[model samples]
Target: MQFRLVKIAETSKKKQTFIFLAAILLALFTTGLFIMFLGHDPVKVYLSLVNGAFGSRYRIEQTLIKAIPLIITSLGIAIAFRMKFWNIGAEGQITMGAFCASYLALNYSYLPRPVLLSLMLLGGFIGGSIWGIIPAFFKAKWGTNETIVTLMMNYVALKWIIYLQYGPWKDPAALGFPKIPNFAENAILPKFLGLHIGWVIALFLVISVHIFMNYSKKGFEIAVIGESVNTARYAGIEIFKTIVLAMFLSGGICGLVGMIQASGVNLTLSKDITGGVGYTAIITAWLGALKPHWIVLVSILFAALVQGSSYIQTAFGISAASAQLLEAIILFFVLGSDFFAKYRLVIDWKGLSRKKENKL
Candidate 1:
C-alpha cells in the first residue's frame, strides 16, 4: 500500500512537469505560425514584440500600468472560478463601481481631497459588491444559473452607464459628449514614484489574496466547497453563506478596476470605462492556474502581448487591424496550449490489452 501511494505521487508530479513543458513549446510554435501567416519574418516580429515589452524602462512602466488593472480583475475572477462560479458579469460590475465612484467624487468635490478620494474608493468598492451580490442572492435562494445572470447583468450595466452619461451625467463642457465631467482634481488617486496608485494597491492586494486563499480557514472551506459541494455540506460547511460571500468578494474586487480607470487614468466615466479589463482578466486568472502570484505573471505577459503588438503596428506601418489580428492569434495559441497541457490522450499502440481482458 505504501509503495502504491508513492508511485501515484510520483506519477502525478511527472504529469505536472510534462504539462508545463508542453504548454511552453506549444505556445511558441503556434505564435511562430501566426508570424508566418502575417507574411512577416517570424524572427523579426518576435524580436520586435520582445523589445516593445521589455527593452526599456518606458516600455516596462507601460506594461506595469496595463498589468495593474488586469491583476486586480483577474484576482476577483480567480476566486469565483476556483469555487466553480461563473461570473461573466464582471464587466458590468466594474462599470457600476466606476459609475458609483464617479458619482461620489463629483458630488463631494467640496470635501478635503484625501477624504473625497477615500469616499470615492469606498463608493466603488460598495458598488461593485452590490452588483456582485445580486446574482449571489438569487443563486443562493433559488438556485438560478449564475453564468446566465451575470452575462445579462453585463449588458444592463453597460446600458445603465450609457443612460447616465448621455442623460444626466453628460459633460456639458464637452458639448453633447456621452460622458461625465472630469473628476475633481482633489479626488484623484495620487501617483506614486511615477507609477499608478492602483499598481501599488494591487500589489498589496495580490499578496493579501495569496495569503487568504492558501492559508485561511475560510479559504479551506471554499476549497472544500469547490471540490465537492455535497461533501462540504456533509462536513457542516454552510453552502449558502460560502456562495454569497465568495461571489460578493469576487465582484467587489472586479468593480474596483472601474474606479481605478475612472479616477486614475480617464478622470471621467464613459460607457467603456472598464476598458474590457473584465474579459481579459478572466483569461489572465485561468492562464495562471487561479493562483494570485502566477496571475500577476500571466497578466504581465498579456500586457506585453498588447504593448508589443501596438508597437509593431507603429514601427512597421502595419494596420491596426493586422496588429490586433496577430495579437489575437498569439493569445489563442497560448491559451489553447494550456488546455492540452493539463490533459493527455493515450493511443492504442500495438493493440495491446491487459491479460485479464485478453483472457475474457
Candidate 2:
C-alpha cells in the first residue's frame, strides 16, 4: 500500500475546531510526560504556568505588556499576508523605525513632549514604510523574490543599529560602554493604569485593521491581487499600486511597534529592541488566520505561554532550555494540526496495485 495526501476542499467549522482542540490536548499531554521525566509533577507545573501568567494583577499586566508589541506586529504581518506578500523583513522595518524615531527623540529633546512624541511616531512609520517599499518596488517592477530580499534586509537593518550603538549614536556618558542614550522624558510614552499606552494603541490598530481589511475598497483590491494577479488586472485593479500601498501600510504598522517598544518598553534604542518579536509575529499572524481580532487572541495566548514558561524556570527550577523546548513542542503540535485540518492521509491501494502490476 502507498500513502497519499488529499486536500480537503471544505471542512466544517466544527471539525476544524475539534482538530485544533485535540492538538492542544495532545500538546499538553506530551509536555506533561516531559515534565514528569524531569522529576516534577505535571499537574503542579501546569498550574504554576497559569498562576505565573494570570494569578495576580501584576502577572496579568506583565503578560499584557508582552502582548502589546506582538499584537501590533502580527497585525502588520496579517496585512501583507492577506495580499499574499511574504514580508519577512518586519525585523528590518522595526529596527529602521526605532532608529528613525530615535534620531528625532535624541535631536529634538528641546521640543514639547506632545510634539516630539508625535513626530517620533510619524518618523517611525515613514522609516518602516520605506524599508517595506524597497522589496515591494523590486517585486512589482522586476519580479524579484520578496522573501529573499526582505530576509536580507533584516541583517542590513540590524547592522545599521549595531553601528549606531557603537559608533556615532553611542552615549559618551556610558564610560566606554557601547550604549545608546536613553530617550528624554519627553520622548517616553505615558502610562495609564500601570501600563504604557501601547496596549491602547494595539487595541486601536486591531479594530482599524479589521475595518480596513473587510470594508475598504483598497482592501478589496489587495484581496483580489492575492487571489490572482491576472484576475486583478482583468478586474482593472492597479496591481503595482496596490502591492506598494499594501506593503506601505504593512510596514508602517510594524514600524509603530518599534516606536512603542523603544519609547515605552526599552526607553532607548538598542540592538535588541525587537527581542525577536518581528519573527514571532509571523507565527501569530498565520495561527490567527490573518484576522485582526484573532491575532489579538493568539498574541495574548503566546505572550502568556512565554511569560509562564519564564516563570517556571524560577519557580520550579526548570532550566531555560527545557522551558523553551516545551514551548517548541506545543507549537509543533498545534501547527501540525493545521495541516491535518486542511488535508487527510489516505492509503493509495490503486497506486500500489498498479506498481505491482508493472513489476509483474
Candidate 3:
C-alpha cells in the first residue's frame, strides 16, 4: 500500500456546503481566540486590516506591488505543480537572475535603455533556466531527489551573491555596505505613470500561460502525467523531457520575476534580494488551485493581508511581528479551506456507519 496523490472526488451539494461552512467557522473561531489572547476586538481588527489594505490609492499600489510578482512567479510554480513536479528552487533561480541582471546593469549601463533592459531580461531568463535545469536534469537522468537538490542549490546561489557583493561587485562609493550601486538610467525599467511597466509584463505572462496550459496539447500531456505517470508512459509521453521543460520554464519565469523586481523596484542587488516571494508564491499557487483566474484573486488577497499587517503596526500600536500573526492566520484558513473543500476528514473513522462508507 503506497501513498499517492489523491484526486479529491466530488461530493454531494449538501456535503460541499457543509465543508465550506466548516472551513469558515474553523478560521473565524481560531482567529477569535488569537484576538482574545491579544486583548483586541476581532471584528475591529479585521475591519482595520481590510481598510488598511484597500483604503486609498497608495494602499492599492502597494497591494499590486506585492501581487504582481506573486502572479508571475506563482504561475511558474503552478506549471510544475500541474506536472506533479515539486520545484522549490524558484528563490535561488530568482536570485541568480537578479545577480545576472545586476552585473549586466553595472557593466553595461552605458548601453541604450531599451537594449539594456532587453539584455537584463535575457540574462535573467538564462540564469534562472540554468539553475532550474540542474536539479531537473539530475532528477530525470539519475532519479536524484529534486527537492533536496533544489534546496541545497538555494544556499549556493545565496553564497554566490554574497561573494560578489563582498569582492568584485562591491560599489566603491558605498564605504561598508554590502550592496550594489544604483542602476544607471539606462539600466532601469520604465514606470508607466507611477506603476512599474513590469506589472504589465507580469499580467501578459499570466494570461499567456493561462491560455498555454488550458488550450495547448502540451498542457494536456502535463495533466495526464500528473494524473498518473504510468498513464503518461502508456500514452507514449516523454516523461523526462516533460520534467526538464517544465523545470526550465518554471525557473526561467521566476528569473524574469527577479529581473523585474531588481530593475523595476529595488534597482540594485542585495544578499536578501528575493525577500520571501519565492515561498509566498507557492501559497498563491495552492490557493489558486493552479487556475490562472483564481490565482489573480488569491494573489491580490494575500497581498492585501501583507499591506494590512503594516497598517496594524501603524494604527493599532501592534508590532509588525504581531501583525504578521493575522497574516499567518489568514493563510492557514485559506489553505485549510482548500483541504476541506477537497477531502472529508474522518476523525472518528470507526464510528462511521456503513451508509457513510457507501456515500463516500
Candidate 4:
C-alpha cells in the first residue's frame, strides 16, 4: 500500500487544542524514557524543572528576564512572517541596535539619565530599522532572495561588533583584554520591582502588536500580501511600501531587545549580547502562530524550558548536552503536532491496486 499526505482544509478549535495537549504529553513521555535511560527518575526530574523555573520569587524573576528578550524578538519576527517575509536577520539587527545605543551612551555620559536613555532607545530603533530596510529594498526592487540576504547580514553584524570590541571600542581599563566599557549610570535601565523595566516594555508591545495586527489598515495589507502578492496589488495595496514598513517595524522591535539586554542585563555591549535569542525567537514566533498574545505565552514557556534545563545540569547532575537533547526532543514532537493538525496520512489503496495490476 502506498502512503499519501492530505491537507486538512480546516480543523476545529477544540480538536486543535486536543492535538496540542496530546503532543505535549507524548513529548513528556518520550523525554521521560530518555531520562530513565540516564538513570534518573523521570517524575523527579520533571518536578525539578518546574521548581527551577518557578519554585520561588527569584526563579520566577529570572525566567521573566529570559522571556523579555524572547517576547520582544518573537514579536518582531511575527510581523515579518505575517507578510510571508522571512526575516532571519534579527541577530544582526539586535547587534547593530546595541552598537548604536552604546555609541550614544558612551559618548553622551554627561547627559541626564532620562534624556540619554531615550536617545539610546531611538538610536537602537533606527539602527535596526536601517538594517531591516536593506533587505527589504533589495527584495522589493530586484526580487532578491530575502532569506539568503538576511542570513548573510547576521554574520556581518557579528564581525562588526567583534572588530569594535577588539579595536576602537576596547576599554583601555581592561588589562590586555577585549571588552567594551560598561554603560554609565545614566545609560542603564531602571528596575521595577526586582526586574528591569523590560518586562513592562514587553507587556506593552504585546498589547500594541495585537491591536496593530488585528485592527490597523496596514496590518490588513500585510496579511493580504502574505496570502497573495497579486491579490494585494489588485486590492490596491502598496506591496513595496507594506513590505518595507512591516520589516522596519519588525527589525526595530528586535533592536529594542538589544538595547534592553545591553543596558539592563549585560550593562555593556559585547559579541555575545544576543545569546542566540534572534534564532530562538523564530521558533517562538512560529509556535505562537504569529499571534502577539500567543507569542507571549510561547516565549514564557520557552524561557522556562531554557531556565529549567540549566537548573537540571546543576541539580540532577545532568550533563548540558543531555538537557539540550531533552529540549530538542520536546520541540520536535510539538512542532510535529502542528504539522499533523493541518494534514493527515492516508493509505492510497487505489494507487497500490493500480501498481499491482500493472505488475500482474
User: Where is model 3 more than 4 Å wrong at Cα?
Assistant: 1-9, 12-25, 322-360
Worst 10 residues of 3 by lDDT: 1-10
Residues 151-174 of candidate 3 have per-residue lDDT tens digits of 788899999998988888888899
List the RMSD of every prediction in angstroms. Answer: 4.5, 2.8, 5.1, 2.5
Any runs in candidate 1 off by more than 4 Å, and if so which?
Answer: 1-18, 317-360
Q: Following a full C-alpha superposition, what root-mean-square deviation does model 4 have from the true structure? A: 2.5
Question: Judged by lDDT against the true structure, how good is candidate 2?
Answer: 0.91
The TM-score measured for candidate 4 stands at 0.93
- Per-model TM-score, in order, reads 0.88, 0.91, 0.88, 0.93
Candidate with best TM-score: 4
Q: Ten-residue segment with the worst summed lDDT in candidate 2?
A: 319-328
Per-residue CA lDDT of model 1 for 1-360, tens digit only, reads 011111222335566657665765666667677668767787787788889988899998887888888899999988888888888788988998998899888888899988888788788888888889999889878989999999899999999988998898888898776668888788788999998699987988899888878999787788888898899999999989998898888888888888888898888889988777887787778778899988998899888877787787787755545534554554565566554544444455434455446678
Full-model lDDT for every candidate:
0.81, 0.91, 0.83, 0.91
Candidate 4 residue-wise lDDT, 193-227, digit = tens: 88999999999999999999999999989999999
As a whole number from 0 to 100, the lDDT of residue 300 in candidate 2 is 94
- In order of listing, the candidates' clash counts read 0, 0, 0, 0
